[model samples]
Target chain A: MTRKHLSTWGAVIFIAAIPIVIAANSPLLQWRDPVYIAGGFAGIIAMALLLFQPLLAAGRLPGLSLAVARRVHRWLGAALILSVFAHIGGLWITSPPDVVDALLFRSPTPFAIWGVIAMWALIATAILALARKRFRQNLRYWRAAHSALAIVIVSTTAAHAVMIEGAMGTMSKAALSGALCVALLVALNDLRVWKRTRPGRGITTD
Target chain B: MTKLHMNRRTLIASSGAVLATGVAGGLAPARAQSLAPTQSMRGGSNNYRPGAPIVERIGGGGFWMTGTVRRAGDGAPLSGQRIQIWAHTTEGHERDWHSHGATLTDANGVFRLEMPQIVPAFGQPHGHLAYDSEEFETVFLRPVMSSARDTTLEAHFVLQPA
Candidate 1:
C-alpha cells in the first residue's frame, strides 16, 4: 500500500524470483555451459536485492532479521559478480568466436548487447559501492548511482531473456518474463515514491 | 482481515488440490511423448544378426569402415542389403530431402561403399535419404564414426556418422 512497503516487496520478489524466472527460459538449461549458468545465477541474485530490500525495510522477519537479509543481499551481489565471470569464461572456452562476437556486440542476436550492458552496469554499481569509503558519505548520491545501475542491470537481463530462443521452454520464458514485470513494477513504484517524497527535486525519471 | 485470511486459506487449499490433480493427469502423456518414436527407434542393437556373408568396404570417413547393418526391426540379415544412399544437402536445398548416398549390408549387416570427394557447402554437403515407407524411413549417413574422424572423405569410413 505505502511506497516503502511496495519497494520492500518489490525488491524481495525480484531477488527471490530471479532463479525461477531464469529457469523458465529453456535454452539456458539445455547446453549446460558454465558461463550461461553462472550468468543466470548472478543475474537472479542481483535482481533479488530489489525484492529483499523492501521486505527487510518493512521489518518482516523472524530469524536473523534485517542484518541477515542485508548480508544475504550483499552476498548474493558478490556471488552474482563471480557467476557472471564464470559465465563469460565458460562462453570463451566453449566458443571463442561466438564470445568474440558477443563482446564486440556484433553477434547475430540482440541479447549479446543486452548481456554486455548488464555486465558493465553491474560492475559500475559494484565499483561505486566498494569505493564508498573513499568517496563522500552522501547517501543520496550512493542511492541514486546504485538504483540507476541496478535498473540497467535488470532491464538488460530482461532483454537478454526476451532475445534468447533456446532450451528455456515456454514455461521458463513466461516465468522469467513474469519476474521481470514484477521487478519493473517495483522500480516504477520506487519512482512514484521518490516523486511524492521529494516534489520538485532534480531526480531525472530514468 | 479475518475474512481475507479465510479466503486466502481457501484459495491456497483449492490451488494445492488443482496442482495435485494436474500432475497426476499429466504423467501418462508425458511418458508416452518421451517414449514416442525418435530417430534412434529406427535402429537398435540385438536387431542385427550374424550368419550372412559380411561385405566390408570403406564408407566415407577419415578411417576405414568396420561395422554391420541388419533388416529393420527383425535383426534378420537382408543378406546382401543393397542400400542406395542419396539425399539433399543438410541445408535442405532445392535438391530435395529424399535422396542420400546408400550401401548394402551382408548377413552381418556390414557393407561399405567408397565415398566420393565432397566439397563443403554453407550448411553441409552430403548424401541424405530418398524414400521409405512410414514404417521404415531412409535416414542420413556419415562416412566415418564420430569419435576419431575429421576428414570429410566419402570413403574409408570407420563408422556411419548418421
Candidate 2:
C-alpha cells in the first residue's frame, strides 16, 4: 500500500481499537447490565468522536481533503449528538432521580455536573449550526458564538470524562483526554478564532 | 516584528493557562456527598434470579451479614441457590474500592457473609447483594446499610418464581 494509504488505515485502526480495548477492561462488563453497558460505551464513543472533531476541523487527518474533512466533521457532530442522547437516555432509564439531579446541577457526583454542562453546550452548538443561514447578515456573530460554545463543549466534556472512574482504564483515558485537549488547543490556535482583527475585516478563513 | 513576537507569546501563555485550568479542575478531590440512594443504585434487573439454596461462607470479620432465601408465595426455603455479594471496605483505596464474593445457601436456605470494617466516603456504609437462580426472577438489594457499633446485619431475600 502507498504510504499515505498506510497511514490512513493505521490511524483508523488505532482509533477503532481504543474503545474495544477500553470496553474489554471496563467494569461495565462485570455488571452485566445491557443498559448500563450501552450507556458506558456511548459515552466512550462520544469522547472518541470529540477526539476526531478537532482533527477534522483543523484538516490534520492524512489522506483527507478539506472538503471531506468538513463533511465528516458535520456528520460526526450529528453522530456525537446521537451518542450523547443514548448515553443520557440509558442512564435516565436506569436512574431518573440521578438524571434529574444531574440536570439540576445538584448531583453530588462531580462528573455529572460537568457532563450536564457539556451536554447542554453541545445541544446549543448543534442548534446554532443548524440556524447558521438565519444569521447570514451577521456571520461574524454566528461564528463567534459557535466557537465559544465549542470551547465549552470540549472543556466540560474533557473534565467529565477525566473525573469518572468507570469504563475506560485510567492511563488510556488520560492519554486520550490529553490528546483531545492538545488537538483542540492546536486547532483553535491555528484557526486564530480568537485573534482580534480590524473592525471591517470580517471573519478570517478557518 | 516585535508585535508579532508578542502575539505569539500571548497565544502560548493563554494555551498554557487553559490547559492548567482543565487539568486542575479534572483532578480536584471529589467532594463528599450525602448518601442518598437512587433507583439506579439498585442493581439492574438483568442480574436477578432465584435458585436452589446452598450454604456459602465468606471471610471471618468486622461485620457479619447473614440471611435466608425463601419463596415469596409459599415461604419454602430455596436450597442450593447462589448469592453474590459486594461491598466497599473502610481500608480499600478509592481506585481499588469494593469487596466481592459468592456463596450458596444450605439445605435450610441460609447464607452468611463477613465484611471488613467499612469506612464511609462517597456515601453511607452500605453494600450490594444479589440472588441468582433459574426458577425465579433476579433480586438485587443495594446499599444494605451497616452500623459501626453493630457487628451483624440481617439481609433476607424472598424471590418470586418466573
Candidate 3:
C-alpha cells in the first residue's frame, strides 16, 4: 500500500486504540457498578469526542474531504451533547445531591464544577449550532459566539477530566485531555476564529 | 497544501507543550478530599431483620452493589449475616422510602443488593449499608460513594465480633 494509505490506517488505529486502552485500564471493570460504569463510559466518550471536534473542524483527518469533515464535526458535536447527558444523568441517578451541588455551583469538588461548566457550554454551543439559520443576518457574530462557546467547552472539559481520579488512568487521560485542549486551540487559531477578519477577506455580510 | 503542513506542524508542537504541562499539573495530588463526607441514615428507619437470608434483588433499574462479609481478623466468611442498605433516589426521601431494604449473606458470606435509581440527597452521591447481627457488632457503612463506571460494585465488609 502507499504511504498515504498507511498513514490513514495508522491514524484510524491510534484513535480506536485510545478508548479501548483506557477502558481496559479503568477500575470500572473491578468496581462493577452499572450506573457508575455507565456514567464513567459517558465521560470517556465525551473526552474522546473532544479529540475529534478540532480535527474535524480543521479538516485534519488524513483521508476525509473537507465537506465530510464538516459533516462529521456536526454529528460529533451532537454525540458529544448526548454523551454529556448520559454522564450527568447516570451520576444524577446514582446521587442527586451531588448533581444538584454541581449544578448549583456549590459542589466542593472542583471537577464537578468544571464538568458542569463544560456541560452547559456544550449545550449552549449545540443550541447555537442548531439555530445557525436564524443567525444568517449576522454571520460574524454567530461565528464568534460559536467559537467562544467552543473554547469554553474545550477548556472546561479538559479541566473537568483532568481533575477526576476515576475511570481513565491518569497518564492516558491527561494525554488525551491535553491533546484535545491543544488541538482545539490550534485549530481555532489557524482558522482565525480568535482573530478579527480583514475587511475584504471573505467576511460574509448578510 | 504547504499551509496545511505548517498548521499540522504547529498543532504537533503545541500539543507536545500541552502534554508536558498537563502531565505535570494533572499528576499533582488533588487538594480536595477524595471521599465525600459520611452522612447519617439512622433517622430514617430500622428495617433490620434476622430470617432465612432475604436474597431477592430488592429494586430494579439501578446498579448492583455486591460484596462479601468476612471476619476482620481471620478473614473467614460471615455467613447468614443480615446486611441492610438504603439510599435516596430521584423520588423524595419521604417516610417508608422503598429504597431501603435488607438481605442475608449466602453460605459463602456473599450478598448482592440492587440499588434503586439513586439521587443525591445532601451534596454527595452516597448510599448506606450496615451489617447487623447478634454475634457481630453493628457495622454501619454510611454514605458509600457510588462508583462512576462499574455495573456492580464489589464492596467487602469486615465485621468485629460483638
Candidate 4:
C-alpha cells in the first residue's frame, strides 16, 4: 500500500524467489554468462534500495524528496529480490551443485559462507521490519540490529563477487565495488539522520 | 594392434588406468597377459615410484574439514599428493558428479572439498562416483614423486557431522 509496505513485500518476494527459481530447472545452471551479469547488477540495485528504505522511512534525505526515495526504495527492493532470484536461478540452471553448496552453506570457497549468512540475515531483518507494528518491540534495538546486518549484506555480497574466479571479471567487480560504496554512503547518511534526531546520545526515538 | 597390446600388458596391468590411451614407449610387448578389471596388485610390485612434486594444494570443505595425506613409509607430508575424491549414490551406480565430483589435494599433501548434497545432471558420465547424501567417501589418492624416489602414499578421511 504505502511505499514502505511495498518495499517490504518486494524484499520478501526476492528472498523467497531464490529456491523456487533455482529448483525451476532440474539439472541446474552455469555462471559464465549474461544472465548472471544482469542478476549481479540487479542485486546491487536491490541492496541499495533496501539500505535506502530506512532513511526514507525516517525522512532523512532532504533534496531527494522523501516520497520519491520511498518509492524508489520499494521498487528497488522488489528489483533486488528479482535480481537475487535471477542470480541464483541462472547459477542453478547452469551449475546446480554450486547453488546447492551456496544454499546449504557447504561451499568450500571462502565467500560462500558469508553470502549464505548475509542472505539469512536479510530475510530476518525483513521479517522483523514487517512485524514491527504488531510486535511493539523496541524500535532502536531492531534498527541497530538491522544496520549491523545491512553492513554484513553489503560486505559479504561484495566478497562473493570478488572471490568468483569465473563468469565475473573486472567489470563485475568494479560495478559491485561502486554499488557497495554507494550503500555505505547511504548507510552513513541514515546514521547521521538518526544522530540528529537524538541530538544527545545519537539514539533516535522516532 | 601393437598399441593395444602394450596397453593391455603394461598399462592396464601396471599403471591402473593412467595415460588414458598413450604410453611412453612404442615398443610392442612380446606377450599379453590376461587382465582383470579389479582393484588388485596396485603399482604391480614396482614398489610405488612417487609422482611429480605438487605445485599447489587448495582444500576447502563445509565450514570444517581436516585430514592428512602422506608418503606411506615415512609418514611425512607427500608434497605432491595427487588425490582424487568422488562421492557415489547409495546404490553406488550413478555419480553425483556435479555435487561431489572429483577433487584434487593441495601442496601440503592435504585437501578438503565442501560439496553440495544435490547434483545437477549434466553430461557427466554414468557410473562414475559421488558423495552420498547420508555418508561421505574417500575416493582416490595417488602421490606424485620422482621415479628415483621410493614412496608410499596414504590419505585419511573425515566426514561432516550427521
DockQ of each: 0.02, 0.03, 0.04, 0.05
What are the C-alpha RMSDs, in order, of all predicted structures? 20.1, 18.2, 17.1, 17.7
List, residue by residue over B15-123, the lDDT tens digit for candidate 2. Answer: 6865786787764543431111112233322222233223343333576677878775456778888777655454342222234556777899898777665443222
Each model's TM-score?
A: 0.43, 0.56, 0.55, 0.44
Off by over 4 Å in 2: A1-16, A196-206, B1-162
Residues B11-111, model 1: lDDT tens digits? 68757855886887752432211111113211111112112222232223322223344333233433444444332222222122221234565566555
Q: Please rank every candidate by lDDT, starting with the best.
A: 3, 2, 1, 4
A63: Cα error in model 3, Å: 2.4
- CAPRI level of candidate 1: incorrect
Which prediction has the highest TM-score against the true structure? 2
lDDT of 3 by residue, B1-162 (tens): 001123575568757855886788775644432211122233212222333245465556466767778775456777888887766543324122455677778899898877654443333345557766688766655433555334554546766666
CAPRI grade, predicted model 2: incorrect
| Candidate 4: residue B34 lDDT (0-100) | 32
Runs in model 3 lying further than 4 Å from the true structure: A1-9, A12-16, A198-206, B1-162
For model 1, how does the per-residue alpha-carbon lDDT over A139-193 read when each residue is reduced to its tens digit?
4566567767767877787777565543333454556555655655554454343
Candidates' C-alpha lDDT: 0.45, 0.65, 0.66, 0.42
TM-score of 3: 0.55
- For model 4, residues A5-90, the per-residue Cα lDDT tens digits are 67755654444343234333313233124454454444444443444544554444444555576566556555655666665675
Ranking by TM-score: 2, 3, 4, 1
